[model samples]
Target: MGAGMGMASDQQWLQLALTGLMVALLPLSYAWVKGRRDRYRQLVWLTLFLTFDLILFGGFTRLTDSGLGCPDWPGCYGTANPFLAHANIHAAEALMPSGPVTWAKAWIEMIHRYLAMMVGVLIIALMGLAWFKRRELRQSPWPATALFILVCVQGAFGAWTVTLKLQPVIVTLHLLLGLTLLGSLAWLAARSQPAASHDAAANRLSPWIALGIVLLAVQIALGGWVSTNYAVLACTDFPLCNGQLIPTMDFRHGFTLWRALGKTASGALLSHDALVAIHWTHRVFAVVVIAYLSWLGLRARRSLTLTRPALILLALIALQFASGLSNILLQWPLPIAVAHNGGAAALLVTLVFMLTRSGPDTNQKV
Candidate 1:
């Protein structure tokens, strides 16, 4: 009996060691790829690629209704992967065929989790690279460290989003955090590359471009709030919500961020009017953001590099507007609705890239 217990302990220790090794492998692999190129610019670009993929995968996870698929955190059924939880998932599905907890949903959710972990790994590798090359690379590692910290916080929010049963505030924050991460990575990438000699003309317009980025970020946050609360089709009419320029709205209830997922401050189920309020507020903000960004894009058309990104931003803005309208007119078809979300993300990335690129690089200061 004593020998058997000792053997069991050894096996358990070995299993944990293997798990740690596997987790470590992800960062190692990323570093290996990132180290091959002497140019920090290429490394930054690789991070951007992974970040973009992460945003898209995040959307896919949300659209598939897989947010709460695992019904647990860090793992599915306390296991690292879905395969181990197959029996439990199948049982849950058998019990509720059309319920939130389905095998497919579990797989999707777990896959998202794995992808998120990989991103975290990449960020860690990025920070490590910055640290290792701090002597040669003029860029600071502080930003990379901050990004890694942000992703960790985002991961915590993601877990809460599941454990708390998809709380609206938490979900909205998760979305916003993802975009913030993307923007930060874009800034890092822009800084890594050698900027064309300081153009006084571009420097003159820097403040306005920065303001545009700030406004766009605020608008994106509002949009995230609207999406989190499932208020996209609240009005279902263009130019006016519910056919009125100023539709009846319960601003208090709609903007209450700390309440239950679908409940009001009074503990009553959220009303349609509350959703309309939420959606309408976002719509109004969207108009302001669109007009400002369009003007900025047009103004920046003279710069060769800035021109293409500006045009892409304009095109995505149009696509987002149309997709949003379709969601209302077509009763929120899933494909168009998802595309609308994707378009918002694309617009955010494009604007971030444009603003970063448009800035005069004062390498003299750093």
Candidate 2:
């Protein structure tokens, strides 16, 4: 809306349409593979799997500081593919050499966009097929239609995440929206699959299990804040923060919800104390998430149907704990850090799977 940002470029519009057609072929191929018996269900499961992979790759893009590799939203340098934008990308890299706009980073950024578009195309096909087979499948296509709409919203935030120059709040919201979409697809897949038999005891604890999910979601938001602000190394130690149990923290500015990328609301540079506050809050919340989710796991494990997801929850929390500790002790190795992001996503989907199976809507065989 600003004078500088202006309207979309002519090249950008044409390139985006070409990119859409390219990614559309992916779903067409996918449907052909699962042409027999409840193929829509197979499509749902496959899309959910790809979405999880996209989230992890998105983490790779962020952690490598390649968010602005192309310096544009959907396309790289006004072109859909890096190969076509080679001249523009090389010029930018030559100007900044070791900066954000490099050839490798451009490839990374463009590939991420391509995968996102592929996921969107698959979701659209899901809506189409679900409606076409509604008579035989005896299921409404509304859920797939809803997913297609959600992917559009997610794509908008993805554009903002780049165009806004990775503003901390905007970037964090973009990551959250991706995870939410992943969970929605997982729930959709679970709905299509036949429900496993659930015993009486597991049915009784659905409310408490739901409560645990909410708590985990809050912890994830705190983790996102710590990440988007680049405050992970504020403490440089696990159990203790900066050699004190409760270091001096600037909660006032640290938790100011609406601020720019690396500055406070008043445009002052973010302070070390504020960074400590954000990091410490995430650290403290992790303990609570681990304990409460484990307890929920124990209760749900008494029933055969809920046992596997509960066990998965326990494993993911353990992985999260180890990876978080490694980030501090090892000075944030890329592999461990990316794994930590995947751990959170796995935990979220596992919970969604459990909830779908336990609810009354999933009690009957497909």
Candidate 3:
């Protein structure tokens, strides 16, 4: 019996190793494509695209109650692939047909894990390339190393997201960290190429642009908090909470980041007022962010270099605002909610790219 058990463990290990390798094919293909074109610059762009997809799919996984579908990290139910967990998932589904741990949910969760591992592999390859081509590249190995560290930290948060039962703080931090990674990657990609030499003139609204970026980031954080806490529907009204301009709110509990997922510090279930507070705060802050970003975009439209990005920013801002309102008026429809999240990420990427290009090519002088 002991020998049989040992053999089974060995087989399981082999299966997981194989799955990890199989998931690496996409990045490997990307590397091959980059090698053929000698366009390492475009590789960064491709990675950015994949990162955005990962973020969206991650939202899908969370929204679908698939976060705990597999109920394990780096593997599904002690196996590397969902096939191995088929029986376990099937059994769970049989027992609780309408509950969270269905086979479909497990598959979704495992697929997400696989995609995440692929992104990690891609980042690893990127760092290696950065180091190999450090002489030719303007950016140093330090940023790549920092990115690697960020991904690792993000992975830890991902693990805690499950282990802690999707505690609001951990999950929200995970989202913020992912966005940070995207922004950093965008900055690196912008720095990798020789800046366009024709337009060396400084953006006159650099200070305002910087301020807009900062404010947008803060609003994203608050939005993440609101989503993680499941406060989207806390306030059903458009301009007010419960038909009042200033409805009753528990800002203390709403802003308390250290509490449990659905409970206050004293361990009681959090009040509806707290949820109202969280949601309303995000709603009110949106007005400030939207106004500033719109103004920034309009200000930037004067410069040819920033005109396209500014317009894109303005369009996305409008789309996000509409989608956000639709969520309240339409009862949080999944499609609109997902689009809203994607729009926020898209806006961030656009802003980052614009900011990176808005400045002069200082490295050319170096």
Candidate 4:
């Protein structure tokens, strides 16, 4: 065990560097576009697009139980790609054919890492471009810089998710961090586009917009906890949990917030009641979020600048509600579960975009 782990540690850096080099090339080529005056804007939007896909793919990773496929951080058996780890993977699979470390699962895990690295590269490109052309870009580069830092923090959580064996807190935080990155990119992108109006009335809505963001963020975290702990199927029913309105719940354990994966801090496997608590909390919180956001969406529709995102918000909420229901009634189909995650991401981005538009566009000309 010691020798094998030592060898893995030795190869880890080289493999990671190779993976970074390979993934960086694509975004670097895109950013290398010659003489495009508005390339910064282009980069922002493109980064936003990639970040959105990354978040959705992350959900796919978690939902398919592929998080542990590679069973290592940043590589499969200390190799950059699963193909190179074929012997190790095959041996492991041969030992336990129906286990998590299958060929397909390894590929899914590596693809997620590759895509994550690609997104990180794009964020770096965005930060570099913003700084290099700060004067010409006419916008503060702080947001881009902040996003770069957030992605780094996210990368740490990604490592922790694997290192900690998908501990509930680490995995859920990983998901939340990814969504935060998406919202940050969306907010930054809005600055580059022309605002419909930056009038005083629109500015007045900033506080409420920020509040909505906070509420939605808490709601997303609750949802993430449910996903990470595999609690979505806890109730397996809509409007009622386990055929009862409240049911027996163990919030103390469910919301313990720092326990190991599938086990409590006391090293006991989590109980059904604990899972019910998590699922119930997320469901109850959704109602509050939906009601408040609906009102906000209505208020936003009155402002032309906010109208598009307001409409998008309503659509996303409907998608989210329906998808959440589908997961329960349809036995948690992969596509619908992934859609629920994506819908939550879209809702976040739309609201952040609206907030960006309503608030002062610092770079806007007189």
Indicate which candidate wins on lDDT.
4
Model 1 lDDT per residue over 1-366, tens place: 999856755664454345544654754566467757664555567767777777777777776778878898767775666787789888988998987789889988877776677677667777887898888776577988999999989988998999888888999899888988888888777666566565555566678788888888888788788878888888978988889999999889999999887899678999999999999989998899989988887877766657778788778878988988898899888788778777877777777777666676645312
Error of 4 at 206 (Å): 2.1
Off by over 4 Å in 2: 1-11, 23-28, 364-366
Q: Rank the candidates by TM-score, best first.
A: 2, 4, 3, 1
**Residue-by-residue lDDT tens digits, candidate 4, 1-366:** 999888877787677766776876866677568427678887788879988998999899999988989998778887878888999999999998888789988998888888898888788878888889889877678888899899999999999898888898999889989998898788777767775655666577778888999999999999999999999999888798889998999999999988898888899999999999999999999999999999988888888677778888888888899999999999999999999999999988888877877876634731
After TM-score superposition, what is the CA distance of residue 283 in candidate 1 from its true location, in Å?
1.0
Worst 10 residues of 2 by lDDT: 1-10
Identify the superior model by lDDT, candidate 2 or candidate 4.
4
lDDT of 2 by residue, 276-340 (tens): 99999999989899999888888788878888888888888888899999999999999999999
Please say which candidate is ahead in lDDT: 1 or 3: 3
Worst 10 residues of 4 by lDDT: 357-366
- TM-score for candidate 3, please give it: 0.91
- TM-score of every candidate: 0.88, 0.94, 0.91, 0.93
Better of 3 and 4 by lDDT: 4
TM-score of 2: 0.94
Candidate 1 regions exceeding 4 Å error are 1-35, 362-366
Model 4 alpha-carbon miss at residue 249, Å: 0.5
